[model samples]
Target: MLGAVGGGALLYLSFPPRTLWWLVFPAFALLGIVLHGRRARAGFGYGFLFGLGFLLPLLAWTGTFVGSLPWVVLSAFEAMFIGAAGAGIAVVSRMPAAPVWAAAVWIAGEALRGRVPFGGLPWGRVGFGQPDGPLLPLAAIGGEPLLSFAAVLAGLAVGDLVRRLVLRQGPRLLVAPALVAVLAMAAGPLAALVPATPNGGEDRTVTIAAVQGNVPRLGLDFNAQRRAVLDNHVRATEQLAADAAAGRVPRPDLVIWPENSSDIDPLRNPDAAAQIDRAARAVGVPVLVGTVLRNPDGRTTSNSSLVWEGGTGVVERNDKRRVQPFGEYMPWREFFRLFSSYVDRAGYFVPGQGAGAVDMAGVRVGIAICWEVAFDDLVADSVAAGAEVLAVPSNNATFGLSEMTYQQLAMSRIRAVEHDRPVIVATTSGVSATITRDGAVTASTRQFTPDVLVDRTELRHTTTLATRWRSAPEWVLVALGVLAVGAGIVTRRRAVRRAGRDEDG
Candidate 1:
């Protein structure tokens, strides 16, 4: 039991705002120690403990302002997915090539976790932690699912190797673990062979700027000062324009703003529109303005990114399709309102419809506003629709100095590599950064500070294998895991029947 909890802690440590990614090996190794040879029920108990140990701390930021209930409830829910994986691992622990089956089972759990109970929260995925690890290259070949599988597979294989050696199991048993360990290590070098044009080599390069016009205050109340927030962005863009005029920096072809940079329904509010229009004209380029649009029904709002050009004003728009469940809008509002007064504070926002990409300055830019980047499909679909570069416009001011921003930045970095496209992350409060196609952070800004990051961004029309395959890798891994579990169940039943016959005889 201690091992299970400790293992979970180790896995959590591997995530960013810290770079102890290698800890993932020992973490899952410890989990293997607790789960191996256990019954499904026992495995579930241990897995639940592991989940609590891991997710409680990882998701602590969720409740920073809203209080502990939502955070605890969300973490508890996500942990159950890990617990399910543990049960599956236990069932297949004694099977041939157990490490393979165990890793596949883990992926199956993640796939399920990313899809259910409100389109799922795909944050805290193991692959998101590997932006600084050696296995990062694998993302180019197979995306996050494959990267996660490799991490678990290597760890479990190590655990299996250790167990066999300690038990002095015959040399024959060592072959499977040793072979798997070797293959897993080889995957890194093999993945590196995949082509990555980090600097857009020979491709069209555009000057892109990410503006972080910080909020006047932190917490949920920050959006209340909508005018102040809008002015801050306007002031920052005017500053960028001045810089360009003074030859301090290159003028950007397109500028990106963080989500909720304008919460004041700019389309409906004439004053807000004027402010945004002023910023766009000053920059002399199309500005991707993140704003809220009130629906005609007056009950729901749309979180959208509208392309604002100097003369044209509003050109193209992409409404956020994957809205944050509780924060953006409440589910079973009346039922949840009974638990917390904050329930009503949740917006009545509806999901927007689009390809998740929009034209900005003759370039098709992919937009994954805030939490949308956490999901695989949202970003991929945008790239598939013809986005040459990716942008993540996020508002992390609500979390305030939490690791959430850093963790999210890590996801963008992984996406950069996964799709082989340059990624620009613009946040309302800070930690804004530009990532190259190889997952390297070229430039960044500090949190809670108003700043701007101007960089030469490469636009690539070519897609990586991961982008082309989309969710295929995840589904394939899940299918194999299900098959492995079935085989294990059949094997166990046959053994039980043979034992009963012998006893009767």
Candidate 2:
């Protein structure tokens, strides 16, 4: 029981806002030890405890203003997925090539968790925690699923090696587990050998300006100061234009504002549209303005990124398709409201349909609008549809000084490597970054600061293996897990029946 909780905590430490990426191996090693040779029920219990220990702290930001109810409920619900994975791990732990099977089962759980219960909140995925790890290169091979599988495979191998040592196993018995452990650890470096096209082989390069116009104040009240937020972004963009004129910074080919930078319905409000137009003319380039547009229904809203050119005003737009549930729109609203008034605070956001890409000055920029980056398909599809670069415009003001911003930054880094495109993360409360195609943060701003980052990034049309394969690797891992679990169950049943026959004789 202590092992499970401790392991989960270690796993939490492995993520961003901390650099203990290597700790994930021991974290999973402990988990493997606890679940090995245990009954399915026992495994589930330990896994739940592990989940609480890990997610409660990691997701504490979710309750920074709304209070503990939502955070606790979310953590507990996500833990159920881990608990299910635990039971599968226990079933397959005693089989041959157990580490491989166990790793596959873990990914199968992640795959399922990412798809259900209102498009599934995949916030704490294991691969997201590996942005700073050696295994990060594996993301290019098979995306997050393969990276996660490699992490678990290495950890489980360590657990098996330790188990063999304790039993005083002979050299022959020890050789296989020891070899697997070494090979698993080496997978990262070996994957690093895969030649990445430098500068995406120079398809094109463009200077981008990511503007971070901070909110008036932290918490849910920022919406009330919507006009102030819009002014802040305009002020920052105009500052960038002045800097460019003075030869202090390079003039950007295109600019991006964080999500909710203009919460006011710029489409309906002439004043809001005028404010955005002023900034676009000042910068002398198109501005990707993240704003909320009221739908014709008068009740629904579209969280969209509109392309505002100097003279054209709003020329193109990409609406966020993965509108977050419970945050963007409440699910079972009346029922959830019975528990807390905060449920009503959720937005009535509607999902949009498109490739999630828009053309700006001949550059095709993929839009992952905040939470959309956490998913695999959304980002992949954008690149597959010919996005030359990616932008993740997010609003982290409500969370306020929490690790949430940094966590999201890590996801952006991973996505950069996965799709082999530079990722520009522009956030309202800061930690905005420019990640190279290699997943390195070349430039970043501090939290709660109004700043502008101007960097030249490669616009690559070439897609990585992760982009081409999509979810095929994940499904293959899931199939392997199912087959392994089935084999384990059958083997156990045969052993039981033979023992009963012996008793009868």
Candidate 3:
């Protein structure tokens, strides 16, 4: 139990807001040691304890607004996946190259966790924690699943080495574990050698602006001042226009507003439409305005980004495809409202269908609104559809002053490398950033402040191996894990039968 908790703590510390990414190996090593020779039930218990230690603190941000109930429930549920991983690891621990099998098991568990119960919440994924680590480059080769597998394999190898040393294993017995450790550790630097063509000469370059308009106030009720929120973004864009006219900044070809920048749908509200039109005219370019559109039934809303062209009104648009559950829209409204009144506060927003890319003034901009950026497929799909650059329009005011923004920023950086595309992150309440295709932040804004970030961004048309393969690598690793577990079970049963036959003789 102590080892499990310690391991979890180490893994949590390896995440964003900290650069201790190397600590993840030791953390996983400890977890491997705890579950190495344990029974399946004991492994599950230890894994659950490790998960609690990691997730409880890591996900504390979830309860910042709604209280601790949801946070606790979420952590507990996610931990079950880890517990199942522990059971699988234990089953395969006696197999040849056990560390490799264990690593595969971890990836299989993550694959499952990323799919079930409302398309899965993939926030605490191991690969997401490696943005600042040496393994970040691996994301370019095989996406998050492969990167995670590499990290886990390295850790498991370390644990195996430590166990062999503690048991005083002979040199002949040590060769395989040592070789695995060296190879796993070497994979990161080796993968890093792969050239990343983010903004090669063939790709085009465009000047873009991402506006961050400070919200009225922090918390869920910030939307209560709906007009105020809309006006804030307008004012910010107008200021950017003034700066451009005065030669203070380059004229951007397009401007992007974060999600929920205009709470009132401009199509339905003349005043909202006029305000956005004036801002687009002032900027002398199309403004990708994020707004909520009410359906004809008036019972549901669509969180959409519309290209409001100067003097032309709405021209091109892309509705956010990955609508967030429990926040953007409630899943089981009636049943959940019984637990907390806050459930009723959830929006009646419905997910939209599209490729998640929109053309604005000859530039194809990929859009992943707020929660959508967390999903791997959405970003990959946009790139597959020929998006030149990526834009993540987010509204983080609801979470208040928490680590949520920075954590999300890290995800964007990882995605930049994954697809080899420059990323523009426009946020409602600061931390808005323009990231280079190489996963470096060129410019960023301070929190809770109104700011405009104008920069020349390169647009790449080439698709990366990660983008091309998509989830295939993940599925392969998952299959390997299942096969390894099944083989282990068969081997164990055979051994048991042989021992019984020997006893009968």
Candidate 4:
């Protein structure tokens, strides 16, 4: 049950405003000491249980959007990697090399989990817990995976301190404590030394307007009035336009609408295009409209954000890099159809691939849409691809006023500081946000509300060390961790041979 408790604790802490909950990871990781050197099966059980405990709650957001099935299914699948991690620990820790081998096995597990099933969930990683902590700069050198490994190292250190103290290995126990202190404290100052790069563009600050075309109703049935939903966004932008014109709100250099604002294709449908044109003409600047585009090669569609410039018309675009498995499109259509009919499979939607950024009137914006914000590579690549400001145009209308919106908003905040770029998050059913490079929210809208957030935060043309060097640290850590495991394997075989010789004698 330690797993369940730890999992619940993780779920509570993973959300916005109070991301401190991630600190539970290192504490939960200490459970390894109790289950230490157990059989592989036992270790797997504990790890799986811990994974279930953490994943069940951490992924409740999936249930909030899709249903309990996805939440349970995804949690179970993700927990498998944790089980494998436990098995690795069981094998590695049995050797004389405890500290090095154990840490490597754990880091390897996290890396594996992050990349499975269409590159992996990677949501509740211990590294994310350090968002507000100084160790966050460590992400520049190593990425989140490295930060996660470091957190594990600290946990291992604490466990080692206890073991050495119990054994009365005075100096060794002191060594463990010293290790913990160093890892925990070094999160500051040194993390700043890692390489970073900013999203490119003019460094000057410009007022940005984020339009939330709030849905009239909330749920699957909500999109019944597709035209009404489209009109709401148009109307909200119209209001912001009026506000800007009168100086009630600062005149924005650009406007943003959330993904899927046009249930009915805007480019093809003259009426829908006309409505967008009117809003752009009113706003007097480029408006990024998230829409479903028709691909000629089949009836399949692409979840795309098109730039609808007032005088220029449709200009630049970015297709969502990562699509939600079941939500955006279904996997193994025939196999799953037997289980549930209401699969609401985004059967028509097509996945779009890009380096993660698109251009807007010489301004490069990184687009982190919906679930993509939770991903490290997506935002990191956007900044690396020369995006100046991060724009997350998401559609959370289906999930309503749960913590999902808030949690996603928090991710935007971390990305701001992680890459030192301003982030613009436009959502269909609220939590529209504008964040600064220092990880502060300049302005935000309430959930399920039709509102506009007006902000003039400095748009960063600079990069943090994290942006310039992405995942380089993770590769290095992985190599070192693997080497430790390999050495442990060799040492264990030698120890077994020595024991056999002693028995023969």
Candidate 5:
């Protein structure tokens, strides 16, 4: 128990702290090896504890933003997947040639974990922590799961070797790295494969700016201060314009503001329209502004974005799809509110229709507003519908200074690679970023600050194989994993039948 706890704590130190993410695998695998020697049920218990230990803190960010009740419930729920992975590992380890089956088991666990409990909170899936690690390149070919597999396999191989060295004792210790080397080389192929991502400070670039108009207050009631928020963005854009003219920074092609930058209902309020016009005209080129729009009926609100065509008020526009579950709108509000305070306070933002992509000069901009980024299908839909460059207008100010912003940034990074497009992420409060096609963060702002980070890059018009295939590779991997397990079950059944016949004879 102490060893497991210590190992789990070590795993906590492995990520965001530095490039030590690889340390987590050996810890998990060693915990597996130690527990595998116990009874099946006991083995599951140990694995679950280790999983709980790891996930409880890793996903603390979830509850950290929402509150303790939410944190406790979410951690317990996320920990179940870790427990499930551990249980799967225990079953696969009982078989002969356990290591190969062990890898398969982990993959199966990842797949299962990603789909359960409201489409599963698929955060911290092992592969994400490898953003700066050598394993990052693997995401292009196999997506996240393959990178996860390699990370786990490397650690498992090390743990398995260490166990053998400690208990069995032999020159066999030397052979483990060679086996892993062959596996890693075959998986990544340093010589033959193209790196999925590119190094920063490259040749081509774009001077794009992200504007953060930090809202004065935090709740939905603060929407009454809509003019103030709009002015904040306008003032920030003016600063950028001055910087550009002074030659401190290159002129930005487009200036992006966060969702809900104009909460005064742009269509209904003429004053709001003029405020946006002022900002776009001040910035010069085009400004993508997130605003609240009401249809002529005025029954509900549309969380929509409009493009400022130079001096013209609103040109191209996009209504946000995938309205947030409890944030933008509520689901089963009366029933859900009994459990928490926030359930009752959610927004009334109505979902919009259409692909939500529009033109800015010649760039095909893919827009996923706030909550929409969490859903991969939305991004895939945007790409299919014709969006060469991606722009995310998110308002993270409500969540305060938390990992939610970083997590959202990570999600945007994956979308960039998944679709082979340059992603410009603009957030209110902080962490606005410019992502290249390769999933690199070229520039970003400090949290809760009014600052602009600028980057220039080639806007890729081409789509990636991942975008064309979408989630097909993951489906293929899952199918193959199922077949492998099914084949093992059949082989075991045949052996049992043969033994029964000999006994009868």
Candidate 6:
């Protein structure tokens, strides 16, 4: 149990805003040691303990605004997936090449965790922690699933080797584990050698700007000053225009605003519409204005990203496809309301359809509004739909000064590498950044600051293997895990029958 707790702590240390990504291997190695020969029930209990140790702290930021109740509840729910994964690992531990099977089981657990209850909260995915690690290159090859597989395989191999050494096993016994570890670690650098199509190797460059206008204050009430938030963005863009005119900065081809930058529906409200138009005309470029659109029924709303052209009001628009649960809209509203009054505070936002991409000035830009970035399908759909550059328009003010922004920033970085496209992140309160295809942050803003980041971004039309295959890798891994579990069950049953026959003899 102590070892399991240590393993979870180590895993937590691997995540942002920390760079100890190598710690994940050792963490999982400890977990493997604890669960190797344990019964399924015991494995679950130990794994749950490990999960609590890890998730409670890693997700502490979640309670920054909404209080500790939601945070604890969310952590407890997510930890159950890890507990189930531990049980699966135990079931497959007796199989030949157990490390490989165990690793596949972990991926299977992630697959389930990423899509259950409320479309699965994929925030703590191991792959997201590897943006700065050796396994990062795997994201381009097979996206997050493959990256996670590599991490788990390497970790389990390490655990196997360590266990063998401690037991004074022969060198012959160590060969397979050593080879697996070497291969898993090598896969990352080898995958990195795959030539990335940089900006599609074309001379076309689009100078784009991401505006972080910030809000009046932090917390849930940040949106209370809705008009002020909109004005802040307009003021920032206007400043950028002044800078461009004075030859201080290059004029951008397109400008992007953070999500909820205009909580007041610009299309319906003339005041909001005029403000956006003024900013667009001043910048002399189409502004991707993030706004809330109230439905005719007034019972629901759409979080939309609209392109406000200088002469043409609103042109192209991509509504946010993955509306966040609880934050955007409450699930089991009536049932949950009994537990906390915050349930009613949830928005009436609904998920939007389409590929989450929009065309502006002949440039195809992908949109993953804030929470959408956490989902694999959302980003892949945008890239597959012909997105050359990706934009993550987010509003992180509600979380206050927490690691949520940095953690989310890491996701964008991984996505940049996964799709081999430049990623522009525009946030309402801070950490707005421009990430290149290699997952490097080129420019970023301080938290709670009003700033505009202008960069010459290349448009890449080429797609990586991840974008091409999409969820195929994850599904394949999941299938392998199911087969391993089935084999384990069959093997156990065969042993039982053999024992019964021996008793009869």
Q: Report residue 99 deviation for candidate 1 (angstroms).
A: 0.6
Checking candidate 2 for backbone clashes, the offending pairs are none
Quote the lDDT for 181 in model 4: 45
The sequence of per-residue lDDT tens digits that candidate 2 reaches over residues 192-308 is: 888654434447789999999998998989779999999999999999999999999999999999999999988899999999999999999999999999999999999999999
| Clashing pairs in model 1, backbone N/Cα/C closer than 3 A | none
- Cα lDDT for residue 438, candidate 4: 64
- In model 6, the clashing pairs are none
Give the alpha carbon lDDT tens digit for every residue of 348-418 in model 1: 89998888999887888999999999999999999878888999999999998899999999999999999
Per residue, candidate 5 scores C-alpha lDDT tens digits across 21-110 of 667666756665665545446655666677666766765665544577866676666666666556555555545545555565667766
Candidate 4 residue lDDT tens string, 1-505:
5643474355346445575744543554454464466666787777787778767766676776556886798888888887777666766665554645566677777777777776576666666656666556665556666666666665655665665677788685476555664665576467776445434445677777888988888876667888898999999998898887887988988888899887778768989989998999999988999888788875788888888987666888788878777777887777777767657554556668888787776678788878788788888888778877889999887776666677677667667766777889999988888887666676788888888888885765776666667666666666776776576557667888999999999
lDDT of 1 at 59: 92
Candidate 6 residue-wise lDDT, 245-266, digit = tens: 9999999999999999999998
Q: TM-score per candidate, in order?
A: 0.98, 0.98, 0.97, 0.90, 0.84, 0.97
Against the true structure, candidate 5 reaches a TM-score of: 0.84
Off by over 4 Å in 2: 196-202
RMSD in Å for all candidates: 1.7, 1.4, 1.6, 2.8, 4.3, 1.5
Off by more than 4 A, model 3: 196-202
lDDT of 3 by residue, 111-187 (tens): 88887888888888888888888888788889988889988998989999899999999988888988998887788
